[model samples]
Target: MSRIILHAGMHKTGTSSIQAMLNSNRDSLRNNDWEYVFLPKDAKAAYGYIHSSPDSCTYSEAKKELEGIISGSDCKNFIFSSEDMTAALQSEDLWVSKGERVSQLFESLGNIEVLIYYRRQDSFYESAFQQRAKEGVPLNFKETLKRLPIMSSMDWYSKFKFFESCFSDSKFTYISYEKAYGGIGITGSFLKYASLNDIIPIDHSKSDNASSKILTKIFAEYGPILDPHDQSLLSDVLCEYERAGDFRRYRLLSLEDRLSVFENYYQSNRNLYSICENADVVDLDIWRADLLNEYSNDYRNAVDDKDIIIDLLKLISATQK
Candidate 1:
């Protein structure tokens, strides 16, 4: 029986880069005695989503699907990476909790190892908002926050218990995603985790998982701030930014607000650290983090135009079916 390694995602904690690296280096990884299973990017077939569902049948279905994947593979080491798998690991669903999903789905597989990355809850959701924006959600920072499921309520203790139930705590390679705490980039850091460092060295700059120039450009100019009242103007800016990749000073969030986010999730995170030995919940007291906008003051000096507002009610009368 070959060993199985799973990378369950704490979304927005650099899972994309890790998955991209594993995908691009699949052939090389196989040469090194590891095979990374490819799953559909989205929807029901996506085991990540199914494994976390409260529906019991989904687990059995996932188990069947997984067995099919493994039966076809000849490699001794198999890798399954999905951020969706841990979506609500801390929450208990009526039918099945996320941890129980893992337990039921892989109960027959025997021994397994898991790799997970933990990020400050506030910081994780902040990055997550930007990701949705890139996908054309047309929502500002705060709007996205309201639309997202409650993240601050997530219980890390339950999450840690969930993974440990499926795969023993000792088999997890938990990494904290704080730079000062030795949070290196995925490709740069995970080779040693997978024991593939001796066989293949990676140049992450070329990894498929890296963020796009349009996004990087936007991040450099503005942080996450957007004008919701100026929908037309904001839309125009959004379109042009994607097409032209322009640079400007944008507001990501306020220092006070960011701190509040840290404070809000602080106790819950501490609870996680107390239960899980594999992860080091960040020490926010001394940990300094980055903001999206560097020139927040510059934007404050600018004025807004009230006349530019376009009333959709008025536009409704201007058009006819």
Candidate 2:
């Protein structure tokens, strides 16, 4: 049976890691009879086609393109991933309510599996806020957490529920973001479940990119705080970076600020975990401590030979190229 796997990210839960892995190893994945459809190369092309024609990009039209791609490919397993899907959850309108767009998409697939990876709320929220900060929109942890509803206006649970309502629970598998450490294990699980293990070789070297939290904090604090006009400019630059496959450095919060932020995240995640008992929530403090230890010991030890600032410049160059 043909299978469709949808890896809908909850954001900041190593979604980029997964996307990078898929992109860097597309050929191998395809050889294993599994096709990963990224936007523009896959679904994004359909989204663009729909946006351009307006009328031609209807749910039916988009579904036809997706079906054609899947059917024409030799792969029996299809994988689609996008963090944008998370926005669908917080939407006021259900997937069905948004015309027949979602329904058509689902109907086009033979066997569909929805995959989600959620982090403890605090960690997810803090990381998300820090991301916004790097974009020059600084919001303290408390304020950012307060805006969770607005951030997730699409009703986070609704997106998954939409699929669940249409498909069985067996068709959905939610993993913990914590399990995504080092990237290989998560990809292995995905391959195993997709039954493409025979085709796709698990390459650990491909998962070499690292987002320096230290650099991220610096950018968050010092990057130009963008207003409307500035934001547009920054967005353009970031888009270019994305196209060039270069990762940007994020600003960091001060030591005091970092601790404050962590505290807020800890409290908030504890509450969220209490309410969402079904979620596989990992403790943020534990993860944070582990990262700290790794950075202080392993990362520093490895890079001790080079000047930290010079190394950062090298990273920037490598990413841009």
Candidate 3:
């Protein structure tokens, strides 16, 4: 009857850092009566069955798969983390059924706690697009936005209600990515929330999750032409610049556009706040102010080819040293 904690990352909410931190401290965490289950093979397939198609697999079979995966773990508690779970929940045709399946899949494990971190709608939209762009999706930012399933993804209230209803007997914790993660940083905030006091020093300098705005732009414009090898080199060059603090801010959304994102999801956000007892009107207002200030100056700022060439030369010279 060990407790089960699931970190269901609603993407672009610092999930990578959190996962990296957990893995780095896995042994220490295990020593402290908690086990972090790494899922990329067998467990991922098992999770996908429950997350994508509810009626595809029986609850008993799913439970057996999970139990088998963690067979040797002697920890008092278990943690499963995956951001892809949020993608399944964002599918318009599958969210509700998936939610029910997810609940049922874990029903055998007593005292299940589902933890989710949600970013602001506007920020979430932009971040998600940027992620696709970084992966060399050749579409421009605006076109990318056109293809996102915004209604299903941004309707936080509806999703929250579905999750609450499905997990009626379990605990569901919803956290605001912007408002909730204070100065302690996302990884620190997560550990705090999970009630873990282990002080595992993470070297943020080498974090792989930090995306380069310059790299995103280059990929968006030239991804189709560049082969895998070229793309990898380009990424390395861009990342070098990013690490040296020489990259410029890239914002494809205008101030007006970002504001409109919030406006479009305004009512849903309010309704979401109604259910979340810790949410406050002041937090909403502050979030708006932060968004406005952050996006006011950067809108479709083009990267200069000459500057990139110069930086590329600089990188090559340094490498030759």
Candidate 4:
């Protein structure tokens, strides 16, 4: 029977890089008997079906659209990826039914490999928030704390259990963001998972631009005042100032708060370790050690007042020019 590799990403875990690699190597993957499946219509329609209500007309339309993609594919084996599927895990009210609906979409494929790459809850929260902050949204530290549980609640066991309950024949494989993202990086890690590393040469040159925590804090604090065009210009300037790494890292949560957040999901994480394939891959020890040692020191809680004023003036001057 042909197989399906469903890379249902827990977002902010290098999902884009993996998808880019698949798109870049489409011909090679096709030659290897594995086709990367992309929904012909709105790419997000696949995720829309998962969140759409069964009572609504959208649910049926989305289901039919998704099913069409699978049935229409010329290749018997496929690799489908969508990070937005992770959003269902956060919806306690809908995850089970959503999982069931999704399982039906893939029932024709006899063998299913559910691939997930997860980061520690605290780091995941910060990284997710930074993405929003960069989009000119105001950041609230207290609100960030309140949102911590939502992140922690997305524990490995619960997510895998959702799949197990929904798809009886599916096999689960979970990898930590730290481990999978090593010298070879997440794209390479995924290639290794598909057993294509040796045959598929990896291009190590592509990488995400360096993001400065200092600029992130500035965006969070001053985003609303800037016009959309100015914000776009500032974003370009940020990329040019990638060397701003010398500045103190902007932190939303203190070491104490971050540890508290991690501990909230500690037991559930440990429980997952027991049942997870190659439990050693989820290295909580190294993660905790880095938190307590390398990241324990107090860091800038906000962008420096002087620096912020200077940066804003510079932005204004550049935009006015």
Model 1 clashing residue pairs (backbone): 221-248, 222-250, 224-252
Positional deviation of 23 in candidate 3, in angstroms? 1.6
lDDT, residue 281, model 2: 33
> What is the clash count for each candidate, in the order shown?
3, 25, 0, 0
The sequence of per-residue lDDT tens digits that candidate 2 reaches over residues 1-321 is 777787767677667767887888788877777788774456754554423444347565677788888889988887888765554455455434431344346555777777777664435555676677556564544455557663543233444455566555336776656555444566665656566666666554544222434433434433455455544444444444444543433323333455555555554444444334445435766756865665456433232312534544455456557
lDDT of 1 by residue, 1-321 (tens): 668877776677777777888888888887877888644452244355355435424545667777767776667778778776676553556214556666566556645777787776666665666666555445556555556674535555566665676555337666776541243456666676777777668454532312233343233233335444434344444454356433333335556667777677667767775555655555765543433343353664232322222332234234322
Q: What number of backbone clashes does candidate 1 have, counting pairs of residues 3 or more apart or in separate chains?
A: 3
lDDT of 4 by residue, 183-232 (tens): 57888888888887865876556444324566665665566567777777
Tell me the whole-model lDDT of each prediction, alpha carbons only: 0.58, 0.56, 0.70, 0.69
What's the lDDT of the predicted structure labeled candidate 4?
Answer: 0.69
Best of the two (1, 2) by TM-score = 1
Off by over 4 Å in 2: 44-56, 94-100, 138-142, 147-163, 166-170, 182-189, 192-198, 203-211, 216-321
> Which candidate achieves the best lDDT against the true structure?
3
Off by over 4 Å in 4: 39-48, 53-74, 147-152, 204-210, 224-251, 278-290, 296-309, 317-321
Q: Which residue pairs in model 3 clash with each other?
A: none
TM-score of 2: 0.61
Off by over 4 Å in 1: 41-62, 150-152, 166-170, 180-183, 206-251, 275-321
**CA error at residue 156 for candidate 2, angstroms:** 6.3
Model 3 lDDT per residue over 1-321, tens place: 888888878778888888888988988998888888754344754675766544445566667788775666788788888776556565656766777766776777657888888877767777777777665555666667777665335788887777778888888888778765554677876787788845465332433433365566666666556677666666667666667765556655667787788778787877877677654334557868987676555453644657676667577567647
Best by TM-score: 4
